[model samples]
Target chain A: MAKIQIIVICTNLIFLAFIARLIIKAKLREEYAIVWLLITVLLALFSFWRKGLDVVSKLFGVYEPANFVFTGFIFFILIYLLHLSIVNSKLQKSITKLTQELALLKEQLKETNKSKIN
Target chain B: MATQLLIIIPCFNEEDSIVSLLNELNQMVVPNTFIITVAVINDCSNDNTSVIAEKFSVVVINLPVNLGIGGAMQTGYKYAWENNFDVAVQMDGDGQHPPAELNKLLQCWHNTQANVVIGSRFLVNQGFQSSLLRRWGISYFHWLNKFFTGIHIYDSTSGFRLFDRKAIELAVQYYPDEYPEPESIVFFAKSGLSIHETPVIMKERQGGKSSIRHFYQLYYIIKVSIAMFFSFIRK
Candidate 1:
């Protein structure tokens, strides 16, 4: 194997270990950690089995395997960003609901206090 | 049960226009059979809008953060739903929605028994048309709504609307958070709710800049169209 491939494999393995530790420590939910774990595993595989990526890219009629990898990376980033946005939208809706409820409750409390003073 | 009406006015930095609008609303005559109240949603305005709104004896919901018109109006709907209001009406805080025509909207709502009643400017074109560019945009959405939802709404962008209890409930549960007016029409129609429009003349806004400006018009059109498309495709 080339020196660069050795370095890539070691880096991917370290990343996988770090994410595994995060999952075990309960710092990340398994549902989300699975995606990161899978990504790290794929990177390790690509580094060790460099010919595998080329073969797959050739089978898919991609002219350049590096282009395929970059495209795949961009596609995954887009999907991940979309997922984050969906989660954000749900959080925003809930926060708005909470704020509205709090305002109404405060008003009711003020009104009640006024009547008692009267 | 007697009808309980809640008028929801969403204000965003409308310190210049809110007081006069509130005064106009206070003087408007509502029917004796119905109980009426006003709720001003102060959408985290950086001005004295909330203080002025409170002076009018209206319920002021001071939002902790600014949630544009859609979020602000949804807060109003949630309030109406929780308070057991029978009907809810939305009017702009910029004094463009004439309080005198509010009675007309309620009449239409009562007569048609529709789930939602909108005060339309193009129904008879009573000489309060918007700018030429805005008119063209409104016309495009009018056609798009008719084609997609099969419901012809002359003024889909008009914020002056009265909602029945069912409509209020639905809106509280699910409402668009941005550019809600036109997209909401599609949502209501797709959900099998009846919508009726009545002729009402709109006045030019007295103060505050429009939320949808000239530069953002394209973005507004594209976003609303995509939202409407998704509403159609969703179950």
Candidate 2:
């Protein structure tokens, strides 16, 4: 029981700190803050809810809540990391596409400028 | 004044709007004193996007395979970097980014000496029209960018922008395919480049539906937030 209470308090404090940091120091995008807030809340909920873990384990035919929660946390983190990797890949590619087009346009302009000067 | 400005337009199966966009660009009448180049990155487009771009005298780069926007743009950058250009602008092929207004961005960077100058529709009440849901998404992105990058971003996800030689060099080497705008901001910031925004009027696209993947925006927000939070401290 005490462990659950400590987890809950820690989670709330972490959330408070995050919010305060964003408001006071971080000039980050609001959309990004929403995403972080959601994730933090989700993590907090997962950390504290013993019944939720037990139910998830029972539903999945697992016997131990600790194992179930631990496994679930690891799985979720892995998926999220993969998701970030995919986004990073896509962002990089888009920049490349636009950079290429811009370079070509500038080249044509250069030729035109040279021709006119001559 | 003695710099070459290249504009890369990434199109994915854009047939209907490609022609109009090309015409607009050609009609813009860039000052003869300012050298300009326009390259269309066709990401293995299944449609006539390549044919249309080529016909307009714009250099068309057809990617051997679909690399999405990031992949297509990377191909463009590699070409630009290899060829040695002074500046690069990223323009969407969806007929939304006004080619005529591109000079505004160039001028902002030229005058202020900023490393990056992005066309910001939010700066002007141009009555930018989009689905309410999309508007919400854009707002969400704007917020997300501020949280992660520690920069007050006027346009968090806009692709219409100009980059200096330094930015182009960095982008070609490290940019990712998805979430290009937010992720690149972090890259530029981490590398200690000054980023700027210029207000521009963007017209609603006339054709070729946006191919944004389902749930990509949400997923991107979470991923980028974490990445930037960590990358900010580490790099």
Candidate 3:
């Protein structure tokens, strides 16, 4: 019923719709979109249940509900960033392997062509 | 029995010294039983490095994209593996690693049968000992590497190294992408490969700038330190 709760509810609703549009347009893959959707839905659930955040924070032994929300979101972001770095490292290894293989194959092809001429 | 020795020269933009280095290598004498083959991995140099190397009778692999020294060296190792080379020696294209002293590495390998042989400038306490600041950095890595792997490498950053078939296979499987020298020593030691160090004189680079610059000293130290740690813990 409070103005802040209504604002939070409206913001999360808009975010959910935006994510749905992205998924529908094939702009976001399902694996990644799942995380975003989970975040938005969690925020929406807390906004709809007025005492939800306060109860959760108290259960987690945090003195302030707002501090808990900030810390929780930051923790999520850090985890996601770590996942991204792992993926990036794998991609880099693959690219290096591919480049090496391509160069080797090209050299082999040249040798084959040279021998054919002789 | 003939030993297939493949010398891997990973070059960047070393047009000034590539020709002379190749000539020196060609002129170097090895034992009768060893058949030496030189393979230069040009790391997408903008200069005429690949062009000049192509004129020689060596294998020249030109990577389309610049994949730093680690990637370039890995390419050479991959080639060595595929071609069934018995031993692979890595030397700089800048002519710092003297071809005349290659016997020291071969002799060490012959006597000790080490899986990997490193040519250390600091072993004899002589010859082109880098600047005071660089020496300090090398010493730091020496101690750090010793602490982690329980193996002491006097010149851990030396590019002059020889890898036998087992070492070459390991290199092809996984190699550090950037700043790999010191970190790789630790990795090889941890992987149960026997490593031996021999004294070899290194000359000041004939041409081309050193890869490690003054501005990037801190970054290099931090990156290598982190890489060493990760390599230690890697399964």
Candidate 4:
């Protein structure tokens, strides 16, 4: 009923719809889109059940519900960023390996061609 | 059986020195039982480095993109691994690591059977010993490595190194990218490999700027320290 709750609900609905559009267009992978969708749906749930967050926060032994929400989101973001860095490291290793392999193969090809000419 | 020695010289824009370096390397004398091959990993230099290197009998690995010093050197190691080289030496492209004194490193390896024989400029305290500031930086890594790996490395950052097949195999498997010399020493020590230091003089870089520039000293120390710490903890 609160204006803030109504705004939160509307925003999450729009975000969910946007994510759906992205998935349908094949712009976002289902695994990655699931993370965004889960966040939006959880936010919507908290907005509708105003007392849910307070209860959850109390269960988590946090004095303030707002603090709990901010900390949770911070933790989630940190975990997501860590995931991204792991992905980036793997990508870098792959690229380095690929580049090295290609260069070596090219050298071998050149040697073969040289021997053939002889 | 003849020993295959690969001199891996990773270069970036060393157009001024590559020709002479290769010439000197070509003329260096090795034991009749050892067959030496020079492989230069051109890190996508925007100069004539690769062109000149190609003119020599040495193998030039022209990287499509610049992979910095660590990646470039690893490419050379990979080549050595692939070609079944018995020994690999990492020398500088800027002519700082002398080709004539290479015998000392190879002799040390043969005598002590160390997995790695590092050319330490400080062992005899001669040749281009680098700046006072760089010496202090080198000492910091030395102590840091001793603390983590329990191995005292005199010249931890020396690029002039000889790696036997075991060390070469490990390097080809996993090597740190950027500022790898000191970090790799720690890595080698932690991997239960024997390392020996021999006194070999190194000259001032003939041409091109040193990879660790004036401003990057602080970042270099920090990054290498972190890399060493990770190496210590890694399985």
Number of the top-ranking candidate, with DockQ as the measure:
3
- Interface RMSD, one decimal, each candidate: 1.4, 6.4, 0.4, 0.6
- lDDT for model 3 comes to 0.94
* Residue-level lDDT tens digits of model 3 in B1-235: 8999999999999999988899999899989879999999999999999999999999999999999999999999999999999999999999999899898999999999999999999989878999999999999999999998998898999999999999999999989889999999989999999999999999999999988898888789999999999899988
- The stretch of ten residues in a row with the least summed lDDT in candidate 3 chain B is B210-219
lDDT of 1 by residue, B25-98 (tens): 88999888788889999999999999888888888888887878998899899989988999999999999998
The alpha-carbon lDDT assigned to residue B159 of candidate 1 equals 95
> What is the TM-score (0 to 1) of candidate 2?
0.66
Candidate 2 local Cα displacement, residue B36, angstroms: 1.2
Which model scores highest in lDDT? 3
Off by over 4 Å in 3: A1-14, A21-27, A47-51, B233-235
Which window of 10 residues has the lowest lDDT sum in candidate 3 chain A? A41-50
lDDT by residue (A40-114, candidate 2, tens digit) is 776677667747877878999999988987897799779878978998867865655555556456555756886
**Candidate 4 residue-wise lDDT, B40-68, digit = tens:** 99999999999889899989899998888
Candidate 1: which pairs clash?
Answer: none
TM-score of each: 0.87, 0.66, 0.90, 0.91
DockQ for each numbered candidate: 0.51, 0.07, 0.73, 0.71
Which residue window of length 10 is worst by lDDT in model 4 chain B? B210-219
Per-residue lDDT tens digits for candidate 2, residues B120-203, read: 888886846567676777777677667767677767678888888888888777776655676778778779898998898888
**Candidate 1 DockQ vs. native:** 0.51
Chain A TM-scores, candidates in order: 0.83, 0.67, 0.81, 0.82
Give Cα-based local distance difference scores for all models.
0.91, 0.76, 0.94, 0.93
Candidate 2 vs candidate 3: which has greater DockQ?
Answer: 3
Q: Where does candidate 4 stray beyond 4 Å?
A: A1-6, A61-63
